[model samples]
Target: MVRASAGRIWSVSSNPCQDQIHYAQLNWDEDGQPLSSVFGDVYFSRVNGLEETRHVFLQHNQLAQRWEALPEKVHFVIAETGFGSGLNFLAAWELWLTTAPRSAQLHFVSVEKFPLDKNDLIRALALWPELEFLSQQLIDAYPCIVGEGFHRLSFMDGRIKLTLIINDAARGFSKLLTTTDPLYSQYSAKVDAWFLDGFAPSKNPQMWSEDLFSCIHQLSNAGTSAATFSAAAIVKKGLKFAGFAIEKVTGFGRKREMLKAIMPNNSQDYFYPQPAYKSASTFPSSWSINTNLDIYPDKHALIIGAGLAGCSSARALAERGWKVTLLERNNAIASEASGNPQGVLYAKLSYKEEAQAEFNLTSLQFAQSFYSSHWANIGKKTGVLQLAHCDSEQVLQTQLQEKFAAADELVQFVSCTKASEIAGVPLSFNAIYFPNAGWINPAKLCEQLVSHPLINVVTGIAAFNIQRTEHGWCINNDRELQAPVVIIANARDAQHFEQTQHLPIKSIRGQVTYLPATIASKEIKTVICSEGYIAPASAGIHCTGATFNLKEESKELRVEDHQTNLENLREPLQELLAEWENSDKHSLDGRVAFRCTLPDYLPAVGPVADEPAMLHSFASLRKNARAFIQDTGKYLPGLYLNIGHGSRGLAYTPLCAEILAAHINNEPQPIARDLVNALNPARFLIRDLIKNKR
Candidate 1:
């Protein structure tokens, strides 16, 4: 949905050459209504409605005294003309989880036409159970599309992002990406608060005409405020002829006057700039774009471990130009199990349709876009749920909810009363939820993924020393250097390199059983999962551990691994731990480490070659390996490895660092190069040089 053409600025009546472009395109009429307009005894809704909208637009748009006087993480962005049944987005997500504050961020935006149906939004959000779990995460992200629509429900990930604009608020505020100036703009950030509630002016008079206040005064910018439950008189003469200053207020809960206005500060010098993003200046701070310029346009790289997968792959390859030195024999950086404090985006969903259900659905959508803005710097969103244990994992969560209907925010399945209202507990099992999943903090996302800018981490410097050199591979992480490429992302201390100790790696030795928080585990705020996994309290305990063992590899620390993580959290919160073993205030805070794996558990990743030149370069198909061939260097040339992402390193380490930087930037590898040579580490010396020539 990325098309628009009213007075074309970016025309496209139709073109589905999509691979990625969904800015949610739209257009609907023929009785699907939504031409919209209204003012003078309020009415609005050319579709959008959540109760003649919160006492006519957020109680006279003062929004709880403009969020108890702003200042912290400042963000407000609310503009609207319609976005039906989102009940003003579940009443501004229950007023930003009850009265903003806590580093604010909202960005609402609206405008829509003919869009509803997911059982007419589950019969109009079954009369809002007081926004019960955000109206069941907007009925599990509405959008079924029988026709016209534009959607973007990011709820609670960037702290509520919304952005629907289905079409026509005078062509979606003239294709926003604003720079401000349309009509003495400035409600705050060029167009802050202004729902204006459309639907009247005589059943939609081209939405209060005069070209809708000349497209909101050419996309405004000048101390704006424009409100309207409607105080008639040609809608205050089209908002005082689109420059704003009108005021009338007093209509909410009992209508008796309401117009509120103010656009003063009109030193209108027209401005709107803000969206050029592409700066990480060898990475250090500020980022929103330059996401390592299309992800590290290689200026140089060679990361290979400083722990936490070489300090998060040397800050995702020196924020994309790879100068990282990390290496490490252990001097600090998450001394393993990524120095846990929290780590549960655990997506193991395959209640039927499998391929590890598209590899745990593209590693939980790149771990929710790599931990979407770090759960407010450490962790929170508190929703992972999962539950269901028997009856074949409740019919594999209904065949992974129809094979992840294009990732309906990671996954759904609920009911044990909407999974006890999103895992607040009280379940008869059966759950799935994953509403953008949560529980992060892994040493503050591994020190914010190796705080970038061509990283040089160093640590206990342990490469020891290597050879092969004509211009690459010199080695000596303790001092010497040179490279063509090198990466191991150490874990199970990469089998002390005798050419990676015949890697078919195995280590397990885990242990987690923390439990402090009470009052029924502090009302469980999501992230529960069955057989193992508990988290939701984080850094204040609650972390219900891991206990794999593989015959123990000890870094010390156990109690039979906290009785195998309280017997795997007694299978799905066993009746919410019926006062968990007669509470003496349950204890045990396990963690042991050693987890690297493989035995077809995938992720060994490319080029660390020359084990009998990949056993005679795949010796006529490992006696049984001819699937397809042509890659004849069988690479060992400059060495590489990302490690068998066993216990799904937070769902496969940033998608195996975008598949080992797209096989070191030859690009295109999103899966398939024979699943990237089935995670190549030279398929066990091409199956022992094709079983000694058969």
Candidate 2:
């Protein structure tokens, strides 16, 4: 086996219509009906297949039996290949979640090359109404990972993780074998049961080859067990060759035979004890449940301001077994600059294949899916349109359209007439219409975010000092509150702490105007962004303005910013307002707040600590990084953060919270692992001091 950890590989271009290729392409005959491969393997060979899965995979895998058998709580790992349509995975997951004991954790590891787009996935899974919610979750988080990387998604807090390896079987299993590269390898997975569900060997030769069987052999333990609908003799021979003693059984559907295999030998001889995942120590617990599990999870996540960053972080942590304590010093959330009645969910694109624009586009899509799935109760799918005012804008849009070459349904070139019609307001220039974009109630969203059961929200609490403790950290307010983890999400107040005093967090104050939606306003159905934004009337309030005044950090409404917004939302709105001849400027209500923004725009997450350690560790970065300890060890111990959401908070928070949780849970991250390290709080310390010769 060519074994040294391989270097980076070039990415295969994905099908423009979907994130990856379509699995159906391999399963269907020319008529697109269920046809076997040349070897005659049906995609789903089980009749009442769903029931058969529950009975065999679930019951035999001893799911209900296992749960009932548990003397103490533990986690179960069920791995699979070819997660086509996710029916089997979802059904199994539903059983685990609903029927399994609350204390039990289920890890469903599956590999998939082709993943369906959301609309189609949602449509396909509609058949299984019982698994609707679970399916929606899988579909929503269906990673758009293009190349070969493990896209780990969290479900049921940190308990269930979908370790979606988005590559061919041979490569994915090879990487899995090396997961314990001798570090942080505790709990490196060995499948308890493998659900083999790839297309027939004849149809997809690469998937069912000897190399694939070799991977299974190298990756699994001697006791590892697997099941498949295929009873083909070649399959039996391959399993036997791979060291798995195979046996034919009653098959599903019209098939009279199926196969199950088990490697009945001691695997512990090859197994190296993994210590990284196993905590070096455990906390003293008053009860058994608390002793074995993270019952006293780190709580008291502080969000100083009720703006996007704080609220979003608070919401994410709160949902995932963390006790979020949001401290807004103010009387209400989003009273600050994020108090806008409506904020546009716009995706910026560049003509020159810009990095920033690409990031924004992906962020926009992730954000939309995040909200649509997580916060659908409060979200509106009005979509956002970026107006192209001039020839330069048009040129950039056209070039970007070609460079992206993604699903055309994502973004479309709308002429003035169509743009005007879609906007529900008249338009003067052509624009790019993002059909999935819309505006959100920032404050309402915050309220929703902090409303989780695990979250204990206290407003009007002014934090004076934050000091670390043996148990956790202390919040110096009325008396003192203890928490294992603390997040300084209080915008400008975050700077008051000694650990973060060097951070470049600043407050930007702004004001927004709220007007009544007229029949003329009905024309502005979608969010329209130029210099400023105008959103469709929500709850009878037509939101406009949002003039950015960097110097004014006060919460008082200013006419200048309003006038600035008026000009920014120009074109049709300008004419409509002037034509109304309504000299009354007070026809709109105004509000203001401070926006805590970082200089470089990226957030300060993970840990906070002395910068000197960071600088010293990464000191050799200016020269050859490999010559020294280039990556700074995580700065703070037991202390981490999730802040600096900025204006992109709506677009960034869901993933940001995910990053924070993954770090704390030691699970795979939602963002690129490199990006996670890049966003580390100690990153700037290393860059400015260690990597900088100047």
Q: Judged by TM-score, which candidate is best? A: 2
lDDT of each: 0.59, 0.61
In candidate 2 the C-alpha lDDT for residue 177 amounts to 42
The digit string of per-residue lDDT tens for model 1 on 265-340 reads 6535422232222221222111000011122222445565654555655554444345766666678777777666
lDDT of 2 by residue, 167-198 (tens): 66665555554231322222223566677777
Predicted structure with the largest lDDT when compared to the true one = 2
Alpha-carbon runs more than 4 Å astray in model 1: 1-78, 84-108, 111-197, 204-234, 237-262, 266-342, 346-556, 564-566, 569-694
